[model samples]
Target: MDFRDHLRKIIHVDMDAFYASVEQLDDPSLKGKALAVGGSSKRGVVAAASYEARKYGVKSAMSGRQAARLCPHLIFVRPRFERYKEISQQIRKIFFEYTDLVEPLSLDEAYLDVTVNKFNFPSATILAREIREKIKAKTGLNASAGISINKFIAKVASDINKPNGQKTIPPEDVIDFLEQLDIRKFYGVGKVTQDKMYRLGIFTGADLKLKTLDYLQEHFGKSGLHYYNVVRGIHLSEVKTTRIRKSLGAERTFSENISSEIYMLEKLEDIAEEVERRLKNSRVAGKTITLKLKYSDFSVQTRSKTLKLFIASKALIMEETKALLYQEPIKDSIRLLGISLSNLNTEQPKSVKKPSIPKEEQLKLPF
Candidate 1:
């Protein structure tokens, strides 16, 4: 018997344009209209965009000015995070009714291991549907779900039919499903990696499967082996029920890149203060301070220092961020600045195995 048949059933659930949807829900006047939730200021970036806006090429992380140019009639609303958080809690309560093996990736997306569920259903597909219905009934928002043998496939599958949809990849179909997937659609493949893969003639899972394991390893290091296994539909990572807080960070993209050290340091101080406030609110302290700089050319660089003691004070965080910022001379005009705290006090759960491509390496799925 194929031992793979015994794999745990996993489900990935994602809310549909959560913030924008909520705005539409609470105010019926906004229904069926293109909407984006975020500051509409010159330097503001979109936090979320509704499906209607998406049709016009609006997207999250796009600057408000660019979004306006893309969708002439796009409506911008400031985010109400507290309201979104309240709805998230309501949906999570429904998830817990089915399984305790829930790992939340963000306020809008989560993974659940339902191989053995509270309802005693053998079909994860059914559970996913019922949970989505419950969410809609309780929150008046649409959610999409994907059921598969592992988190990776399930998460990717969730995007297949988005905005109130679901898809399931049976165990027997895993290999074929992946073979047909586009290289750009793979979970951890960013623009840089995608371009590299294109150069290597790996454009699909089928193409990736043609390379030798040694060849992959030689090219991509440990992550190469990871890609090899994923293409073959083999991932051993488990759904983590208890997750540690990895980092607390905030970033701001500017309307125009700034090259002046004085201006850059001023922005860093603002980011550091926000990060400090969030750390205190969460009651977590960290020893590592990271400074993220995004250049005008779109290239990104991060500098980090792990201190001997955990500190959550704004003064200390700013002090460290400034040190890291000044340690290296400004190379180019910077378009963004961010500050983060990591190496937190919470312990990593032993039940879940870390992926070969670290969480930091994985790009947030567009879905």
Candidate 2:
């Protein structure tokens, strides 16, 4: 089918409070409580928060300490990735039964092109309903869906009626929907971008739609063009069947900031060993090594070097990291350190450092 025709039947499926919900599902005793899934230590960040905790302003990415301050009664639980992946696979199996044009944004969310589904269903909304029902029955968990003419709108709509609900934005309503959307809820607008938009007096999609494409590009770089197009219901990207691994990385924030270089080396060794183990599991190696350091004040510094050839050994990774560490003097105390491998042998891999508009064929899409 033509890509344009396929655009009209996309559905974005997202699990509700995935990690916390899974934890609650496995232990029903924990079900109605305000839960934060991750370590309870001062340095730990909440990976996910239950709906109850969200009402208390405890959310994912907030420090456990802050989460505790927000809700003194918040319960903490460690994450189980293997178990989540197991259930995710089962949920995906249900998706494959309907369509193969499934693009997973993460384990808990995906975009599916149901333009031509297995059951030959005429209405994508009905298909999305059935898919969510199947997920609920099979996993005893709730899944939300948004059906729209394009992926971006579907993704945004998915969040409107969440936790076992669905929303559909038909083709005729796409333009008005985008225009009425808050600039903050435009899907791609981050806090930084939102601040920039506020400065530009662009508070809503209607406000964004007023700016010229060239003006946006001058301000937002290439992302400006994206803002212009999406507000006009012109996203031409398609759901991919496969997603490539861009980079493998792990980071840890210390309970207390450290200033001594000697202590930093000890932490680097442990992080490099972890990178090696992950590289081996993925069965891929890379030449580019990036060492990330987050200072006590939350400012971040990154150093990277690409080798003549890819190497995966912990010894080699550590050897390179040690040289990079001393390459420049670190002026401030650090609270977090991380290591990652990129430029993999996985045939033209792209790093996930920034969000760029898809490079698919772009044309003036009629709203």
Candidate 3:
């Protein structure tokens, strides 16, 4: 096979401290200061924090009180989810301008399969730089991008030069790059796995590569295959437009089965809140809300409501779910209560209108 013909070009883009950076961009005073965005209440966690705050040891998922203790000068602000959602949509629109093969990992990160693109650029490195420049000019925010032959390396390269930077790894240098990488830096190697690898004398990619496939498979199970392929710069995963959902459910397994109307209402409130959070995090809106119940003797029944439009918010989900839950009779003691949202919108790609190619040019390969 031709070397260039078998190669793939992928890019990964990630925003720097996305939510906190947006806050600083909108307010000049917040720049160059230790700032965090989330509730300051004792029960709340930090959703996002600026790099300045990170220097003081503040991090996301830590309790608000813990962050305050770590950085006495920390400035806490509430999350404006609506504003963040609007900005996310703007960034997504920019990705579409380059290629239709975008796979969003979250609100702040995405992967683009740009082996073929609308701009007719010869280098993925150049395309990445252009995309970063466009984002900065349009949003007044900084972004990091990585370009490489596959998604794994591209994702890692993006982080190599962070906070308004781009890095590219040509195919020839991929092996040397992987060999020197720390085992902890590998995608699936979390803290627990890192410790296990250390005990086994696998501290770097070189060490991991030296192990036999059988050895790795016996030690790490199915993940060994992933490790072997990625370390060797070989990946066959495709950027999928749609993925099947694993599960859909809503339930209230009550502490005690009660027949009182007031008691059931309180239980339903908790269930609705959980369902709403899951929908938003998954970026899915569902048209169907299902209510489930179990009797004291273990008999189960379900009722469902279908809406004309998809719903994603807590209030709307609760209203519809409560209505469905009440539709069924509550004659026996209820042991379990549940709610589920289905018929989610995964968002598919639109058809790209390819530019017409001349007969002579079409005969020769584009890349």
Q: Pick the candidate with the highest TM-score.
A: 2
* Tens-digit per-residue lDDT, 221-274, candidate 2: 989978988898888777777677889877888888999999998998899889
lDDT by residue (25-140, candidate 3, tens digit) is: 88899999999998363435689999999998888977677899889889998788888888888888998888888878878888887777877676788888888888888888
Better of 1 and 3 by TM-score: 1
Error of 2 at 216 (Å): 2.0
Displacement of residue 311 (Cα, Å) in model 1 is: 1.8
Report the backbone clash tally of model 3.
5
Tally clashing residue pairs in candidate 2. 0
Backbone clashes in each candidate structure, one number apiece?
A: 0, 0, 5
lDDT of 1: 0.86
Error of 3 at 203 (Å): 0.7
Q: For candidate 1, list the clashing residue pairs, or say none.
A: none
In model 3, what is the error at residue 352, expressed in angstroms? 12
Reference-based lDDT, each prediction:
0.86, 0.87, 0.80
Per residue, candidate 1 scores C-alpha lDDT tens digits across 1-367 of 2316336688999999999999999999999999999947455779999999999999998878889999989999989999999999999999999988899888999999887678777778888999999999999999999998788899999999997999998877888999999999887899999999999999999999899999999998888988988888777778887777888889988878899989988887788788888998999999998999888777889999999999998899989988998898878999889989999987655785432323342222111
Candidate 1 vs candidate 3: the lDDT winner is 1
- Best-to-worst TM-score order: 2, 1, 3
The collision pairs in model 3 are 250-338, 250-339, 251-338, 251-339, 252-337
